[model samples]
Target: MHPINLNEPATTRPTLAESLSFTCQLGECRSELLPLLSEVSKVVSGEGSLSKTLKLVLELMQKHLQVTRAMISLYDASCDQIFIHESFGLTKDEIEKGVYYPGEGITGKVVETRQPIIVPVIADEPLFLNRTGSWDKTVDCRLSFICVPIMRGMKVMGTIGVERLYNNRQLLYLDLEVLAIIATTIAQAVELHLLERAHKQVLQAQSARLDKELKEKFKPANIIGNSKAMQSVYRMIDKVSHARTTVLILGESGVGKERVASAIHYNSSCGGGPFVKFNCASLPESVIESELFGHEKGAFTGAAARRAGRFEEADGGTIFLDEVGELSLSAQAKLLRVIQERCFERLGSNESIKVNVRILAATHCDLTAMVAKGTFREDLFYRLNVFPITIPPLRERGNDILILAEHFNAWFAKEQQADVPAISTPALNLMLNYDWPGNVRELENMMERAVLLAEEGVIHSYHLPAALQPAVLGELGEQSGLEARLSMMEYELIVEALARFQGNMSRAAAQLGLTRRMLGLRMAKYQLNYKDYRCGD
Candidate 1:
């Protein structure tokens, strides 16, 4: 008799007499076998847990088949061995000893050759190692054994074996056929379980990678400032990041208060949680309340669905309220309650919901001044003032402008897929002397524009906006004195000459019809550096 080929249907190979004989016995075992298959099917299709499904398979086999011992040994491809994964009618100690190398015994040989084996009598078959100690060699054990490979397509994943009394030999072939069918089902279930586990692992790895990237992007080191004022802000951030204190970031309109809030959230103890932000000034006064504390369905006109508020959404995380000073007095009252009690009701509902969200508020307006004018609540100001961090305006952060310029240069270069150009000394000097009223936001926009305008692989002063030109040029018309005006024009001529000649003093002086020594004296008087024009070289 040849081993059954699992790749084909189980019914294809048997002869008419063999088929009739198995069919008669199959009918006899139908009462018990039908329920066993039903239960195994439920297990395999439901949760698809491999261990639980294997355990159920073994338990049903022992109960319905009246086997002395039953075991399922799964193949470990890494070690090329079959280890007992689930077993019925065996002690824990005996199960621990049930391991076999390829072709070691009946069970191992079945797995190694992807075939089935049946021993009519265990005492007569030399290949039956009895590693599980189901039968004693000293006694006359009348046990018959059958083992079959659990095949997935052409590959054998494991083997299922059962031992029964010798008197049950009349239906041995029938039992083998049933076990083979069950083994095929087990193989498919195992394959599906493995595939699902691998897919979950891939998703988890991708999630972890995205989380790591977000954390790094918002880390304190990436905030882009080395000024003393920014150093103080960094220290404040470090001190309050792990705490649940309410942070109030004070700065000018374009000073990156939101970025500071994000840095605090992503570096805090609740970094893994969500960070929800709302611009209180951007929304209308009529709907700002509903936006912060979401309203119920049909609560107001066009309110079609129940929506979670930022506070509710940011539970166990952080919420940044930008332009907090713009909130109405009624909204301020509701916000004050959340800050003090950590609970608030929805806009149209009286049901109070509790949340554990960290508050990080930012505003360009002075809340204290607004409170004096009765536009803001005084009590709310004190509550939000627990930990105040003031970000310096760009004019006060000396030399940080150059650092930020380079950062923006590289960022926009990559964004536009262009090469980052070197900043000329004249351009750097103009940036340093300019009093940036729009702060970092304006500087970032200006750098992006400069990169777009740059054509010679270097950022010259001409690439900068006309607004960045010296205040002296704007002051010329107001200064009515002829001497002052003439001196200004002379200074301009010398600078323009030097710039036109790429800082070559001889060429500049010859072009301007002045000796090199006289041009050097004028350059000193105007505080102009000749080397700043060398980009033309």
Candidate 2:
């Protein structure tokens, strides 16, 4: 079986796409696959910045493939060693301790053997690499792993690597195949990464480097956070970026859910893929369907040309529907059918247009409550919620408040080309104290305003909106005690790391630099259960 056969006879083996939704559902997995392969050619020619490309690639792996992490370790042909060239979600300690290496580990063994190996449980795998004599100090408790040789023709480039979850359940054969696909894609991309670097060097040496000017297309940029909450978002993105799953992003207004959606599509296995976006709330009933699914020429009064809809235009890539909660019942039903079947008909045309689109949706409204109220269809909710991710409101994410404020300050300063200025102590305190009802979005707007208004070298409290800057020093007294708030903040940050790392206490601890036991005790104290919150849709 091709592993993509949608319908399988009961006696015959079930197809790989049978369990997976996108390949079979879209009826054009080949179309999707070839495009991504072709995209590598474009990626090679695009740039020579290894870090930017690798960072973007790793981020995409998180979004598209649903894999916890991805790596492109290469065989240093000259040095006869494996270089842990690029990775995401791996800690500094792990990478240094031969996480993926020729330094006495499984990857090294795989390179030595020139064959792929599957360890359903890392614990049970033979002792090939023992950088650490035993598992006593290794942060990697992730036992389910697969290492495939990155071969260029018959020559092995390096080892393409993947792990299921941290300390996860045993890896099934099916999971092995999944890892193989990831390895195949990554091996190809990494090879291109190397070729790109070489070509970039050639261009730079010749002074023939092309000027890369990116137009400000108003696609969301700089949705920054490395805190536990954002890490959780990064993980969820890792899980579903490449797959054709229906993703539902839930968050309050200004939580940057749309930005997150864009990240998912751009970082998924389809990072090079086209991204088509529609604000469902902005359009009326008659236009919404036509705009999203497309309309034929003369289908509507002003429909002069046969235009491809967002779904078709985003073929082999992603289509993001923002504010999907606002969709009318009839529209919701049609959306549900399209999501379920991956086929739609243009207005005034009975012929079905099949598109290879990965669907990502975001809404500030609570779909569960809406479903309960009969405003949203339960079926649509179920389809979209196959993978559901929630972005925490600003108030809930602890000191990320300050971190994001700093990020926005820098970004807005550059955007508006205001000479960069530091925030005054009073201004910083005001921002940290305010409960951002609009989350990151609100903070960004406030920073933009402050940067514009500040005539002096520093942003002061007086420049902030009246709601944020109160004259009375006593206003701070009305909120929770600072000590108590900091304690809760510390507690939440710990829990977020645990969840973000998929309960890998060691990696989570590395991110926080706390002992695994220390992190656990805090979890026990706070009574936090964050297992489901870590990995994304």
Q: Each model's TM-score?
A: 0.51, 0.47
Query: Candidate 2's residue-wise lDDT over 1-537, tens digit each?
Result: 011122445335334444344343332222233344345445433533445555655555455444555566777654576766777656666666554445347677677766676665555555545342334325546545667777644556677666655332211334444545555555544544454344334434433211121122222244654456666776787677667678899999988888888877776787687888899989888798888878889997999998778888888888889999999998898888788788999887999988778899999888899999999999889988999989888877765676676677778888877666555444554676689987787888888888887654446555677678443323432456766445544653554455445767778776666887887786666554446344541
Model 1 ranges with Cα > 4 A deviation: 1-219, 471-537
Candidate 1 clashes between residue pairs 3 or more apart in a chain or in different chains? none
Query: What's the CA error at residue 359 for candidate 2, in Å?
Result: 0.5
The C-alpha lDDT values of all candidates are 0.78, 0.65
Question: Which ten residues in a row are the worst by lDDT in model 2?
Answer: 209-218
Which candidate ranks first by lDDT, i.e. highest?
1
lDDT tens string, model 1, 58-88? 8788777777788888876656778888888
RMSD of 2: 27.5
